[model samples]
Target chain A: MSGTALTQQRDLFARLVTLGEEVTDALDHTNVVSTLGEEELNRAIAAIGDRALPDAATSALAALAASVERVIAANDPHRAIDWIGMQPRLALTLLAATLNPASLPKDVVPPSSGATVAARIPAGISFSDAPRDGRAVVYSGIQADPILRPLAVAIANATPAERLIARAVMNDPEPTAAEAAALFAALPSHRTTTDPLVVGALAIGGKAQASNAQYRGAVVEATTAEMLRRRPVLANDADRLVRRERRFAIDGVSADPHPFDVTVEAGPVPELWDCKWGARGIDASLLAELEDARIRAAGSSARIAIGVVAFDTAAIVAARLTIVRAPREKTRFITLETLGRLAAG
Target chain B: MARAVSTPPDAAHPARRPARFATRGHDAAAAHLATLLADAPPHALLIVGPRGAGAGTLARDAVATLMCGEPVDGGPCGACRACRLIASGSHTDLVVINPTGESNTIKIDQIRALAAGFALFSVEGGRRIALIEHADLMNEDAQNALLKTLEEPPSRTHVILAAAEDSRLMPTIRSRCAVIRLGLPDAKQASELLGERLGVDAPTAVRLLRMSSGRPGPLIDAEATGDAARAHAQIRRQILDFAATQPHARLGQLGALVADARAILVAGDDDGNAADGTESDDSSDDAPDVDAEPKKKSPAKRSAKPTPAERRAAATALLRLWRGVARDLALVSTGAVDQIAFPEDRAEIEAVAHRLPPATWGEALHAIDKTLSALRRNGNPELLLDAAALSWPTL
Candidate 1:
């Protein structure tokens, strides 16, 4: 493409992004937009036509636009609710179309075929199950696409840590025991683990890391683990066994078992730590989760100490205030430093 | 008989004797409230306005009128025992609720307690008033808890809610209350009021009034308002400076811009919270005592290291400022310089506007807005800022 054409394409992309943001905002709140007009929606629909997007993507955009226009015309009180229902799918389609327009199929693929392929792939590859080669085989299939070739090359040139994360996200086979151990050991000190390529790979393949919220949760988990390992007193606790992705049935916590990010089984009382990434993350849900855990632990003779490890001091403070109504003697709010001290004792 | 000395009306001491409800440019609202007080007032009244629009003042004035033992022109006879008690914040029949703690939210427990208080008869055998400031900050459960009170308020009791952003209130809660919307005050009147309140000269008052978008409430704290005005001016200059630099140079200065923005936010918060005195809940025992280490430095020095929320708030504020600049640039470019927010910096803004097309300013505006939304949703601040920087038009 010529320079002017590329610039035009970029401008269009930015407009689409803005439209997406406005829609998302409107969906988030009822009164964000006093009047939901179709001017922007129409412009976005026209812009999508101008792009070389796949038929499915184009149809999806058109449908979303039509739905929004219909809602606007109806002047429905639940217009925000309708928008909320439709925005995520619209956003996902826009994201895919914008990210790699060249890779999109000229001919629409069957949904069942796609689902079958997805099913054939493993659910997830555990840290111990990653391939030793550290090659992201998932990219091999898409390397032929002109738009993604540069991204593939970028991944090829990424650091070993990034490659290992990318490989794990791609559901590749297990790495050798030594290689897995080395990579796991290096994760605490790895500065570039959140590289764009690695994050992109995780977004594409890891269900848990699909959204920004979940991605931040993962990053916070890593940081918490790193901080825990950095403290010698906590790290050298012979009685302590730290594990992630541990699910426990704490009676009324939930109908199903609750999954904790990090569970430390030390002495008679186990410690359940849930990592809230930011101030926004420390919300009502966190309180409910912590409260449930506390109630469950109490029911079981107060055998577990509920802890929340949050990075933001304001978030920790907010969470503490939010849960002050409950009996919180066994529940502790912790930063990484405080968590280390508590463990040391 | 010796004449009693009467102090001059002051914004800080709003509850002084002879409560005049002297807000300028709100004559219609005052009249409406007076009419309500003259007869049966609404069981629940919602006073809605943007930040610094004086919703709190209006609410207080209305409450004082309802609780006043002696009425003067449909306002409080501030010399009465009841008025004196209200002024001292010791009125048994008047209860005020504010968002508590670092959470800056009115939780359900507070609302429940308020409800329990409503069950009692008024101490004065008169109307009992519950005033909730920043009612928009009430969480979902709190709002829900308030819905009951709003729906069936007790006999001889009034519930007044003052919200900067009333849209955040639940529809059920909003529906029950008689809504009184406060728009931006008349500019000329606002400037005059600000001049009298801040004891500033005409030009300075007008400038400060423009900075506050014609809100008189924000001018009560002359020092904090001045600090905010200076910070805004600095941010405008930074934007102009950034625009003057090459694209690559602009990218290089991003870190400095972010740091400066964060510092300005910290300073603003420190000054604003202190000046307002509404956020006293931060010192409550309910505050998280996890970080028990005492820091004996000034608040500014201690808060220099901001939490993640603070950082996000700073970035959001910076982007908002950038959006304003972009808007000003657009206005200037379109020969609508009179509509620009930062009138004092018109020449500098025009200089940059001359360098860029109107389309570029529009694009920057949209980019900043998009980044703002993303930042609110907890997007990585640095990455979002980087993306926004790339979209910024360079001179």
Candidate 2:
């Protein structure tokens, strides 16, 4: 790069950081981040990273610059970015960082932006409240009403242990051994992990499935088992055998029970155990199945217990079972916490 | 969540036209509607708007004109037999599908029945009309069920689906209709209309108009329900009560309050035990009482919120209602005479009449807006409630 261009690039980096700071403040204060054109920041980011750029890069860059200018015009110079709202600011900043390779610190890993952020935002909040016609809210912690700034900062600064805890807390209100396994699977690369590809594979079940209120616990269990296979300490070459499936049935005097909607089978389970996921543990209504399992495994003993897993504000009472007795009636009920403690031990 | 806001059993008054104001910014849309109504095209027509913006009146007017069997310019001749029946909501050709008493959703089956009827014959022996109110509340299945009817509307059958929220309709549903949008009158026009037409005192009419956000339906409905002014007072009072409470505990209390309010509205004062014993005694006498219970229960329950999600939801809902009420009251305060609020909330309205300055109310609104945005993220719901819980009382 020529001296003038190099000088301009250095100036651009400083300007970008300042923009980031202003965007953060704007989000913290008001709602104006939608006035941002992320494309402009991408070009700057691309130049900083010295990598190839897409054909659309130039137009996107112009749009970003124009948006910034619009934001400036909407408010006084002193209050330029300070007037934006938190949500829009966070959205714009996250969007810019996603497009720019250089934004991630040397040690830091990056996540995708746009629909990813939209997806991560909890369901109950309405995007309708966000200004649809103009700008998204800009938040960076320097505003009178700082909503998620501190939380964002904490996530950005999390240590390995803290990140693990944060991940678990975010997933299951009550982090169980199963939940931990899912969190482990979700962690960023460069964090110490036994096997990266295995962890990635585990998360491929996708957050959409993982965060579902009904399926989350089961998803955690299934994902954790997969994560363990990466290291083999928990289990090796074992896959989920079957999971709970809802089916309408008849209480007939004579009829065979059939299940539909979903089913699973172990790839190879001569040396493996099946996993069941539940909040109050498996349903009490399913006790007949437990008894049947016990009867089917007469040579083996079974146990079942209710587990109390405490989250930040709530607790899930679950039932865990291990087939040790042959008779289904001989099956035992154990709480999941006890199992978690046992696993931890 | 909608409740009666007007005084109870006002001296009987003659039926008048559905409330209306000057059509602004929507002349082209309205003109398109007029032409379609003139031709009585086989296609269904959907008129959508925010709650209280008067979409229903537009639909009613269009139907009246189509079935008039006599033409006088583009508007309906209010004196004609067809116009009279449509206005009275008893026209055989005009089918109105509303929630059955306490039922909330406009069911798919209900739409199917309406479609079937439309498929049969016209009562007016002219254009068959179906006006579905609160059209947005239709579930996806119901919306889809209406799609076939909407896409290929029967000969001489006109369907007008009106909603307070237009976005709630399926794009497919929307694309099929010629949409007519309605908006609240400007302050001056709304003020004049309320005073001359509704018999509201000049000053109170202005207040009702401002409080109703210049929207004629809500402006009229608020007076009828008598809850608009009362709700504004209750919201203000509740915010003050919450503001005094510590943040952490306030959310839980607010949430509990909201749930309890819903329960109370849904269940009412006859303690479950008492109701069981009296269940067979006087069903008719008890039914109205039961109906009245929810009217009381809803606002109280809605005002309860401890978690941010519930709090923000409650607050946002309240704000939507508040805009109309405050507009009514503001008109009253400003001495504008176009709209008169229902007389029921007169007492509460008077009590809070100048408790907070207008600017402070504006600030409280902004704070509520902030809480709503935060509720959208992964931020703790409790914290969001905390923010509102703190700011709400100060207003």
Give me the candidate number with maximum lDDT: 1
lDDT string, candidate 2, B55-108, tens digits: 665665676777777756666767788877865768888787664544466788
TM-score for each candidate, following the candidate numbering: 0.52, 0.38
RMSD value for candidate 1: 15.9
Query: In candidate 1, which residue pairs get closer than 3 Å at backbone N, Cα or C atoms, i.e. clash?
Result: A129-A174, A130-A173, A130-A174, A130-A175, A131-A173, A131-A175, A132-A175
Worst 10 residues of 1 chain A by lDDT: A113-122
Cα deviation of A114, candidate 1, in Å: 54
Query: How many Å off is the CA of B7 in candidate 1?
Result: 34
Candidate achieving the largest DockQ? 1
lDDT of 2 by residue, A1-345 (tens): 322322343343334334545544333221212222232233334334554433233332333333334334433322232212111222222223334322211111212222211112111111111122221122111111222223323333333223323333333222233333433322232222233322322232223422333233333333323322322222322223222222211221111133211212221111112233332223334545534422332323212221222111111111011111122222222122122221221
Locate the minimum summed-lDDT window of 10 residues in model 2 chain B. Answer: B270-279
